[model samples]
Target: MGRTMGLDYGDKTIGVAISDELGWTAQGVEVIRRRKPEDDMERLRQLSAEYGVTNIVVGLPKNMNNTVGPRGELCIAFSESLRESLRLPVSMWDERLSTVSAQRTLLEADVSRKKRKQVVDKMAAAIILQNYLDSNSKR
Candidate 1:
């Protein structure tokens, strides 16, 4: 089976997570610095190919009340772009508390605020992907 990728899309950075080839665990991969849409698409396409990823789980940032906002719209657009460019099944998962969880995790780990800023995105992506994996595994 091919691996799955997770994305935590943000305004400045897109955090990436990749599942193991066995499809068991999720690991934070890298944070892709956003430049242009076309360029980011190309980079993702390359990463997908490199990792043999066949599916994607992108985070959809929704308000706590479950309303889609501008950031959520951007995620939708990014998912659509990924589907078109990577030719993979790109799905979205609600990521309301992922960042909060990430922050808490960093705090518990004694990570400084500055360091947390650097790794929070990747950790959030890992959390997002792990949640998806667990949900699908329960099926």
Candidate 2:
């Protein structure tokens, strides 16, 4: 079976992660620095092809009260664009505190501030993907 891709889409960067072929776990790939819209899509397409990704999971940063705010709207738009461009099934996973969790994990590990900044996005993507995988597995 083909793997699934996870994305943590942000204004400045996009964190990327990929599931194993069996779709049990997620591993961070890289952070794509945001540039042009087309550029972002192109990079996604390339990574999708490279990783044999058949599905996509984009993190939707909802508010604590479970409301979709402006950031969530952006994620929805991005997911739509991914669906249109890649012709793949795109799912949005609620990621209310995925980034915060990532930050805390890094801090607990004693990761340097600079290093955390460089890797936090991808780490957050992995957390998002892992959470999605876990929830889906029980269904």
RMSD of each: 0.9, 0.6
Residue 133 in model 1: lDDT: 91
State which candidate has the highest TM-score. 2
Model 2 worst lDDT run, 10 consecutive residues:
128-137
Off by over 4 Å in 2: none
What does candidate 2's lDDT look like per residue over 1-139, in tens digits?
A: 8998999999999999999998999999999999999999999999999999999999999999999999999999999999999999999999988999999999999999999999999999999999999898999
TM-scores vs. true structure, each candidate: 0.96, 0.98
> lDDT: which candidate is best?
2
Model 1 Cα displacement at 54 (Å)? 0.6
Cα deviation at 83, candidate 1, in Å, is 0.4
lDDT of 1 by residue, 99-118 (tens): 99999999999999999999
